[model samples]
Target chain A: MVAASSTKSISVTLRVWRQSGPKELGQFKDYSAKDLNPNMSFLEMLDVVNDELTARGEEPIAFAHDCREGICGTCSLTINGKPHGPGKGIATCQTYMRSFHDGDIIVVEPFRAAAFPLIKDLVVDRTSFDKIMQAGGFITARAGSAPEANGLPVPKGDADRAMDAAQCIGCGACVAACKNASAMLFVSAKVGHLGLLPQGQAERDRRVLAMVNTMDEEGFGNCTNQYECSAACPKTISHDFIARLNRDYLSASLRSAFRPEAASTGGGGA
Target chain B: MNLVGSFFRSSIGRKILMAVTGVILIGFVIGHLVGNLQIFSHPDHINGYAQFLHQLGPLLWVARIGLIVAVVVHIWAATVLTLENKAARGSNYGFKHTIQATLASRAMRWTGYIVLAFLIYHLAHFTLGAAQSATFKDNLKSYVLTADYRVAGFPVVNAGTKVADVYSMVILGFQSPIVAVFYIIAVGLLSLHLLHGIDSLFQTLGLRSNKWSGCLRKVAIVFCLAYFVGNLAIPGAVLAGKLSPQSAKISAPAQR
Candidate 1:
C-alpha cells in the first residue's frame, strides 16, 4: 500500500458498505477525503482513506487483498455499479484514479451475488467457485512420476483452445455481470479446457457432464446466450468457449443415452 | 434429497429440467395448434374436439395436475438457479458493450416471466372461461344455418347449441385493438423466450457437441419461428374477419 503524497490535491466522496460479518446487516457510510494523486491506483486511494481512519482512532475498513497486482484476482469491488471500476481488462488494483474526473462521487460496494457471501466490508466468500472447480476441473494426471513432455502430441488448434479456456482466474466477475447470474461461462471454460485436451480424454465426457451437473446443483442460472459474463471477465474469456462447452455436453448426452459405457470411459482422443 | 434444490443448483439438473420442460411445453403448443386448427374445419369438428376433451373429466384433471407439477418444478428450478447465479458474482460489471450480446439473450429472464404471465392470462381468459362468460351461449339456429351454408366444401357456421358464447367472447375480446395488440406482443415475447431457452437447455444438460451445436441452434431458430407463426395465426385470422364472430361461438365444456 502506498502512502498518500501531499504534492497533489483532490477531493472525492466515497459511499462504502460497512458490515462486521455475514449475519450483520450492512449500511453505507460516507467518507470525505482530499489531497489524492490522479496517478495513484484505486486501492492506493483506499489506503489513504484507511490511514486517515486509523489516525482518527477509527477501525479501518477490512477488504480482501494479496497481490496488489491484478493477477491474484482477490480484490472485488463494485465502483458505481461497475465491477473493478470503469477500466477495461483490469482488476480493481490496476484501476488508477485517473479514470475518474474531479468531483466524482464513487459508490463502492461489495459484490452482491448470493453465492459470494460477504466476509467483512468489501470482502466476500467465493467458495462456491472453488467447489464448482473441485467437482471436475482437474485431469487424471498423477504427480511425482513425470510423463514425457511430448508423450501426447496435441494439435495446435486444440492447444490454443485449451489455453483460451485456461485463462479464466475464477474471479467471479462473470457471475457479477450476468443478469441471470448464470455461471455457464465460468463452468464452460473449465469444461472446455479439459474436454479439448488429449490428456483429459480419460474423463472428458464424465467431467463435462458431472461439472455441469454440479454447477446446476449449486443453483446457478441456465445460460441464455448472455455474453455479459465473458465481456465482464477481467481475463476476457470468450463466449466461444461456452459454445464449445455446449457442443461437448450435447454429444456426451447423446452418447450416454445409447453407449453409456463408452461415455463413461470418454470417447475420442487426438 | 433436496429435489428442488438439486434441480436448480446443479448445471446438469438445470439442463435436464430445462430440456424436459421445454420439450413438454413445445408438445403442448403443437397439440394446442392442432386442436385450434379445427376452427378452419366444420364448426362441429372443433366443437366435437372440445367435447372429447371435456368428456375426459377425471383424466383431464390428472393431466392438468401433471402439467401443473411440471410447470411448478420448471419455474421453481429456473428461479432458484437464477438466484444462485446472482449470488456467485462478487459485483456488477460496468460499461457493458452492446456488440457482445443479442437483445434476446440479455433479456431472457424478463421475457420468460412476461411470457409466463401472458400464458396464465390466456388460459384464464380463453380456456378456463373465467374472464368473460362462465358458459358457452351460441345460437344453435344460427350455427346450423351457417353450417348448412357450405362454400367450397367448408362450413361457414356450424353452431350447435347455445352452450357458450365463446365466439362472441373471442370476437369481442379481439375487437379491442389493445387486446389484439397485446396478444401479438405476447407471441413475440414467447418466441424470444423459446429462442434462448432451447439452446440453453442443451448446454445445461451437457448434451451440446461442437459438431452438432450449429445444427441445434438452427433447429431452435426454426422452432421459435414456427411457434410464433402458429400462434400469430389465430389473432391474425380474427383481425382479418376470416374467423367470423358467429363461428367463434363454438365451445366445449371447460374441463376442470
Candidate 2:
C-alpha cells in the first residue's frame, strides 16, 4: 500500500459495519481517519485506519480485496446504498478518496443480498455464483493441442456479443444492487458468453437448463426488470444479455420438451 | 417436467408470458381503439358497426371469451412476478437511488393495477350495464333510441327493456364530467403502462438490439402517446359537444 503524502492530507469519518461471523448481528462502528490523502485509493485509506486500530490494540477492520487494480472483483462494498461505491464502471477498490469531502461520514457495508450471507465486516460469501458456474459455465472441448486462432469463422456480431457477455467478473454487485436479489444478470452473462461461441453451441441447450436450475436452487430471487444490476455493475455489462438468456432458456426448454434425447445427451458436456 | 409447467415456474419463463400476453393485449387495444374511433363518424357509422358486431352471433362470444382469457392471464402472470420480486428483495435499502429506471418503468405495477381497476369499471359501465353510478345510468336511460333494435335479428323490446343504442349511450356517458375525468386519468395511466411495457416486451423477447433499441423505444413512445390521444379524443369530443347524436340530423337514413 502507498503511504499518504503529507502535502495533501485530509480527514474523514467512516461508519463501517462490523460483524464477527455470519450468525452475528452487524452494527455500524465509527472510525475517524485523520490525514487521509485525497489521492489515495479507497482501500488504502481503510488500510491506514486499520494500522491505527491495530496500534491501539483494537481489532482491525476486515474487508476482502485482491488484485487491487479492480480485476479480481473480491472487493465488495456498499457505499451509501450503491454497490462498488459512487464511481461508474469501476469496482470498490477503484474509488478514490478525492470523491469525498473532508469530514464526510462515509457509510461502508457489505453487499446485502439473501444469497450473499455476510461473512464479516464488508465481506460476504459469494460462492453461490461459483456453484452456479460449476454447474455449467463451460464448453466440453478436450484438453489437447491448441486450435488455430482463426479456425472458427464466427460472425463479428456474435463474437462482439459474446465478448460483451464475457466481461462479467462474478462480483455479485448485480445481486447486491437488485431489489429482488436476483442473479439474472450474472447468470445471463455466463449463459450468454458460452452460448454465443461456436465451441459452446454443441451443449447450449443443456448449459442454459443446468445453469438456470442451479441459479434457482441457490435461492436467488426472480428478475422483475428493475435493471439495477446492470446499472450497479462495475463492468457496466448490458442487461440486454438477460433478454438473450430468457430467449435461450425458453427455446432450450421447448426443444427439450420435444426432443428429450437432445437434453439427455447434451448433459455429458457438464 | 412438461415444458409449459416448467416455463411458468421459471422467472424468465414468466417474463416471456408477460411479453407474449402484453403483445396480445396491445393488439386488442389497437383493435378496440379503431372500433371506438368509428364514433367520430355519423351515428349510423358507429351504430351500424355495433350492429355488425352483434350480428357475429357465436363468433362474437368466442372473441369476447378469448379477450377475457388474455386479460386474465396477463394480470395473473404480472401479479405473480411482482409478488415474487417483492419477496426476493427481503430487506429494503436504508438509502436508495435509481440510476437508470424511468418514472414509467418504476410505476409499472401501480399503473397496471390502476388499469385493471379501470377495465373492470369500463366493462361494467359499457358492456354489462351494471355500473349504477347515476351519471352512467342516466346516460343509458336518456340515450336516443334507434328504430327496430334486435338481438340476433329478433326484435324483443319488452317493457323497461331498452334497445341497444350504442351511439347515444357513449355520447351521454362522456357527458358526465366525473366520468370524463376518470377516463382521461385511466388512459393516461394506460399510456404510462404501455410506455415501459412495449419496450420491455421487445427486450423480454430478445428482439431488442443496440441498433434497434432506440428506434423501438421511440416507436413505443409514439404508439402509447397516439393511443392515449386517440382514445381520449372520444371523451374529449363528447365533452366538446362534437359527438352529440341529437344535434346531427337523424333523418339521414341509418347506413347499413
Candidate 3:
C-alpha cells in the first residue's frame, strides 16, 4: 500500500495468440515477462518480450498500437479475455502492469468478428468501420468557415448530447465486447452524434438508413440489447445511443416508404 | 426502399419485428393467466366462463390462429438472430469471461426452447386431450348452471342447462405429481424468460431510456415473480387436495 511497495518489480507469464498470417493457424504461445516495473504499460511489457524474442532469433510478436495515451484508438488488444484489459474507460495501451498480480498469466488476443478479418498476431482489419463511416457518418451541407458563434444557436441539451456521443473513437471494442459482435453501439454513436445537430438534420433519415445498411452489409450481427458493448467500450459510450438509432431507423424507413419520389430528397437546413 | 422489403432485409428491422411480436406473446401470457385464474371461483362460474368461450366459435378460432402466428414469428425471428449472432462472433475465444451479462440474458435461447416444449405439451394435455385421455376427455362430469351462472349477470339461456366440467378436468389433469412438477419447472423457466425478454423488448423497441432503465428492470422482476407464483398456486392447490372434483374454496397462497 506504500509508494515504496509500488516500486517493486513483478514477473508474469503471457499466453499470447500468435498467427503468421491471416490464413495461418494460430495458437497460444507462452512467454515469461520478468523483472518488469509494476507501472509499465501492457504494450511496454510486450516490447520487453519482443526484445527477448529478437535476441533468441525468434519472430517478434506483431501487435498494433500508436498513441500510448489511449486517444488514437489504435491499440486493439483483447487482454485477459477483455478488450482493453482489466480497466474501464481505458484502451489497451492504458492498461498497466499493476492491474495484474506479479505471478499472473495474462492471455492476449486480437478482436474477432466476421467483418474484421485477422491480419497478423494481435492485429485485425478494422476497415469495416471506415466503410461504415463512408456510408453516411457525414453531412453534405457546405457551411464554409466558422459562422458567428450565435448564428446557429443549437439548444444546450442537444449540444451536450451530441458532444457526448461524438466522444466515440470507433475502436471496435463495442463489437468485440458484444455477444453478437454487433456494431450497433459504434454505429449508433456516429448516427446519434450527427443526428442531434442542426446541420445533421438535413440528411438525418438518409444518414441512419445508409449507415445501418452498410453496417449490415459488412456482416455484423444484430443487437439483443444485452449491453455488453457499453460495458466493454473503451470510451464508455452509453447504449442509449442505440435506442436513439432504432427510433431514427424506424421513422426513416416509414418516411422513405411514404415520401413521393420527386420530394424524397431532404431539403437542407431544418 | 419498400417498407416490407426493408423491414425484413435489415438486421435492425428484423429486431423491430422481434420486439413487436414479443409484445403480442407477452399480452397472451397475461390474458391466459387471468382467464385461468377463474378456476378458483365457484364451479358454475368457471363452467359458465368456459361455455361462453365455446360459444364464441369462429371468433375463438380467429384469436387462436392469431396467437399461433405470433408464436411462430417470435420463434422464427429468434432462431435467425441467434444463428446470425453466432456467425458474427466468427471463432470462439480461447479465454472466455462474462463481464456484466445477467443469467437470464445468457440463458435466453435455452429457456426459450424448454418453454416452447412446455407449450406443445400443455396444448396436447389440456386443449386437445391427446396427452391423457383418462384425465381429460374420458373423465365425464357436468355442472348445472344456476342463476349465479349468468356471466357478468347477463342471462343467455336456461339456468338449469348442464355444461362440461372443465373444473374437474383441470383437477384430475394435475393429479399426477410428475405433471405438477413439470408445470412448476416450465413456469419457472418462463418467468426467467420474461425477466430478460420483457426488458430487452423495451430496449429493442426504443422504449427504454437511461431514466427508466433501472426502474424498468425492477418492475420486470416484480411482475415475473408475481406471475410465477400465480401459476404455481394452481397445481400446488390441486396436489394438496385443497381443490377437487367435489371441493372448492382452497387456501390462497398457503398451498403454494
Best by lDDT: 3
Of 1 and 2, the candidate ahead on DockQ is 2
Q: How do the predictions measure up, each by TM-score?
A: 0.70, 0.88, 0.94
True A-B contacts kept by model 2: 0.53
- A best-first ranking of the candidates according to their DockQ comes to 3, 2, 1
Instruction: Report the C-alpha lDDT of model 3 over A62-111, residue by residue, as the tens digit.
Output: 99899788888888988878888988888888888888888999999889
Measured over all alpha carbons after superposition, the RMSD of each candidate to the real structure, in angstroms, is: 7.8, 5.2, 3.7
Off by over 4 Å in 2: A1-8, A56-58, A260-270, B133-163, B245-256
Candidate order, lDDT descending? 3, 2, 1
Candidate 2 C-alpha lDDT tens digits along A56-172? 999898898999888888998888888888888889888888777787888888887777887877788899999999889987778488789798888998999899889898999
* Model 3 per-residue lDDT tens digits across residues B124-183: 988888887776734655667774455566765346777777787888888889998899
| Candidate 2 chain B: worst-modelled 10 consecutive residues by lDDT | B155-164
Model no. 2, DockQ: 0.51
| Candidate 3, residue A94: how far the Cα is off, in Å | 0.9
Q: Give the Å error, residue A169, model 1.
A: 1.6
Worst 10 residues of 3 chain A by lDDT: A261-270
What is the lDDT, from 0 to 100, of the residue A203 in candidate 1? Answer: 88
